[model samples]
Target: MINDSELILNADGSIYHLNLKPEDIADTIIFVGDPDRVPEVSKYFDDIEIRKGKREFITHTGHVNGKRLTVISTGIGTDNIDIVLNELDALLNFDFETRNLKSEIKSLDIIRIGTSGSIQGNIAMGTILASEYAIGFDTLMQYYQKPYNSKELEIQEAVIEKFHDLTFKPYVAHASERLLKKFAHDIPKGVTMTAPGFYGPQGRNLRSQNTYPHLIKQANTFKVNGYQITNLEMETAGIYALSNMLGHHAISINAILASRVNETFASNPKEIVDKAIRMVLDRL
Candidate 1:
């Protein structure tokens, strides 16, 4: 059995999975999927103090515009978000030495900067799309037992009923409005659709049998009230869900590098990503 004592670290010791101690992180965090992007993001930090990595997870803690922040790579998908978000919460809210809770909880502000495909035709290449809400098509939420908004649940139920032929259950959640406001002008805002995979899960071409053949069309045309599905990504739903549950403010900004319907990729993907990152830094 894994004991709490064993799971917990010494006050000055680092976390088991992230290899990071409390002092290694700041209250503001930027999450990316590429390990290399950790350095790419941290390069803009005014004064970087710590850098660490394990497997696909790389971290750098520093100051940007006088604000202390940590840039971490969560690899890809909600499963990785499960690990990173939980560990980050523990690092901030738990007493590492005693394996007990702290009197006051520290809520971190998280922003995910990643690449995604545009679902809407008008959302062009090199554009940055911020997620106002994320529709999760993953199973991570089955583990949680909590109350959700009634209107959101109704929308999710309708979506599931509409796509009953598909294999997975639909999950939906919204990003933090506070974070959205903070980064609003930094990137174009839209509703981001989160899927399970880049291929079959997202209605892409495959050699074998596939699921949700009309998913792209359904997602693209589907709108909740007037909000349209603007982009497709893998991690935003999980980030929104976990961040909401943990009382952290979180948002995702996707650089539109691909258009699934048109089979086109941004000619200058790096330039687009760099521009998005620079805008985010300036806003921070």
Candidate 2:
């Protein structure tokens, strides 16, 4: 039996951080980074059943076209992704009363619908792109025992070689082939670079100076085995990495809201995100 500290549950028996019980979610889940966007996705649901939240995590479970779906917000960053994924897996595969793992594990289909900035000019603003692979420039994966395949290792090695002077190492993770084929096969697919922050880590210099001034330029030119860093975002790599580790199928569908290459931002960011949301919902 797992100890209380290891598998912490609420007084009501829901998961600690997510404030969600096993029955509160669906097998197919959509993840949004912003809490406000939680309703944006859930609005399309035919009917919403359960709504729960705590901190930056807000969850809405419902159905659309007779298909059950759940949309939850992870706030931002891979750090939140760590908590969200683990707790979600626990809800699905752990017996909360027993505080133990179930005999049969269940894998959830996780789809991330979020906004991003295109690093490449060809990927215009308002375009919907799917991340076939994501390279994390964060330290979240370092704490996990991640095993990479030959393709993933090659990409990781290439990133390490490029950013050799960096203090920490980067990790590579791919989207689930099943989910990718199911939801994003027809769309433009490329590599996404998941930064730790919006400003410096993403090469954005507002009032502060960036250590790597040419970071975005370098990312635009980066490529390995035909996969280039196409866009910059904050969550896909974490989502993909943790999903892979937890035996869940995951994919990130990005609505391009900014263009680093063109130096432009979407005039109607909500409309862009809405289009992506509808596409995913229709596909789902």
Which candidate wins on lDDT?
2
lDDT of 2 by residue, 178-197 (tens): 98998998999999999999
TM-score for all predictions? 0.94, 0.98
Per-residue CA lDDT of candidate 1, range 1-50, in tens? 33665465534478877889888999989999999888888998898899
Give each model's clash number: 0, 0
Could you tell me the C-alpha RMSD of candidate 2 in Å? 0.9
**Candidate no. 1 TM-score:** 0.94
For model 2, the superposed segments whose C-alpha errors exceed 4 Å read none
TM-score of 2: 0.98
The CA-based lDDT of model 1 is what?
Answer: 0.84
Clashing pairs in 2: none
The top-ranked prediction according to TM-score is 2
